[model samples]
Target chain A: MTATTDTTRDRIDDALVRLTPAQVTIAVLTIAALGFVLLFAQEPMVHDSLHTFRHAAGITCH
Target chain B: MTLTDHLVRGLKAGAVAGGAYGLFVALIGNPLIRYAETFEHSHSGGGPVVPRAVTALISTAGGVFLGILFGVVVIGALYYFLEPAIPGTDGTKSYLLGAAGFVTVSGAPWLAIPPQPPGVEQALGVETRILWYLLMATVGAFACGLSGYVYTRLRPRYGQAPAGLGAGLVFLSIPVVATIAPANPVSGSLPAELAFVIQAVTGLGQVGLWFVLASAHAWLLRRDRDEERTGYGRVDHRDPTEPLGVDP
Candidate 1:
């Protein structure tokens, strides 16, 4: 058997092997969504989208 | 297994746990909310409020969503990331982790600022209240998580019961100290007894939710163990058909 050198394709393949595409997608999406929430969640502010959640979850916003 | 696989499983666990939580809220919490609202009205004198039906629907829906999200993000994603560093299996201590979560997210914050009945005025400003809530919760979570590590380290030296006792004290101390923070202004409107009922019901509900979440996640992990190994070994890793599974 002859020895072969690793190619660019092999390196890219190895690099992609670390994380699944789904992981990347989910991570990015979660980060973006959280960023949006953190950026805009203010009082008398954007919208009380989670008003029901706040009360329902036993969080005091009254 | 890949972190993604863990997250997928976690989401399934979250949904099931979240459903159980929603069921609990619907079964018990809905009625309490109605009674609390009525009490608030009787005490404070308010105009017409939303119908009981609407309140129940909203509450149940909201609870389910919240449970799922917490299961996914906190239990699933965060747990996965932290697992690499945590020694042994990820969920070796489910009950303990769940208890820690409860103390961190709700119990500690509740101490800092107890839930207010409707038609009440808050002593602290809105922003300040939110700031304190987040700060206390975050600090409490860290303290609780640290205690677990401390317990593990001490277990060999001191033995289980003693180590757990020490760690438990360390865990309790953070919230006890945090109790010094100014409390929300209470409106004398609602009866103390009724407020107590509300607190007790909601507190129990949160505990139930966390319990269900932990158990559900553990079950899912056990059920999906094989899939995780195979799924991790795969390349490209984008399986649209990949299931976020929960057992029957």
Candidate 2:
């Protein structure tokens, strides 16, 4: 019974170990992908409009 | 696995994911956006200039989906194949790491411009056009993706540094710095300068983003190694160590 329990524990431990790398990779990839979309997708118009609006509002620039 | 091994894996994953995502955006997303724009134009009797907010929201969503697909398909495939080459790496972990890294660096900049500027009838010079910007972004993403693919090919074969490192260096130090240089003949007005600044800042940010992406790849590689030792079974282990194989 003790031997069987040890084997089961080892299996679980091994599974956990194997899972760590994949989990990390998935985590990184997901984060990076989401980050790219969020950062790059929405800024151009806002920046351009803000500039235009500011210019319209009598803001001068060098 | 060692840092070198992890780094190599990460670069490979980044390249694949980036490339796939870029391609999808160019081929699939762009067309979809165009179609949507056309549909909008046809329906409204002189539509209230499809707001930048609406266009941006749609494009960003498209980009996100593309990024996710890239992570799942391209990076996942590369990880499976390359994991074995680098001593202790596992396929599953590599995929995960690549996915995480991709999502993190995917949406660092949040801005959009419509293909046609609102209320601007006469076409501004082609260079400053919306189409041009989209093309540039597409090309940039493609280049980044190609770099990822090349990184994968080079790493195990030559045992070299991650391409992201070199990309990060060049992107940050050169073009970005050049944009900041006073008296850029390219940009005339302050608004133009501000636009240029936004580009420069984003370019520099890309370098940091790439570095983070590379780090994530490395982390995945390390995790793969641990998985191997722990005897974790993968969902699809057969092609896990084979390069560029189709996912089952």
Q: What C-alpha lDDT, on a 0 to 100 scale, does residue B143 get in candidate 2?
A: 43
Instruction: Write the residue-wise lDDT of candidate 1 on B1-248 in tens digits.
Output: 44566678778878988898878778776666556666554422343355455656755776787677778776776665554333336456455556767888788887787766454556787678777788788878888767777777888899989887877787677767677787666665667887777777778878888888888877777666654556654355455688755422
- For all the predictions, what are the DockQ values? 0.14, 0.03
TM-score for all predictions?
0.74, 0.32
lDDT of each: 0.65, 0.39
> How far does residue B146 in candidate 2 sit from its true spot (Å)?
12
Please tell me what DockQ candidate 2 reaches: 0.03
Model 2, residue B222: distance off in Å is 1.6
Which TM-score values does chain B get in all models? Answer: 0.80, 0.35
The C-alpha stretches of model 2 lying farther than 4 A from their native spots are A1-62, B1-53, B79-190, B232-248
Predicted candidate 2 versus true structure: per-residue lDDT over B1-248, tens digit per residue? 33233345544555544454344444444443333334232321343344745544444444334433443443443343334332223433344334333322222111222222122222244334334334434444444444445555666665656654543433332233223323212312224343444334333333333343444555665666567667685354465566875433
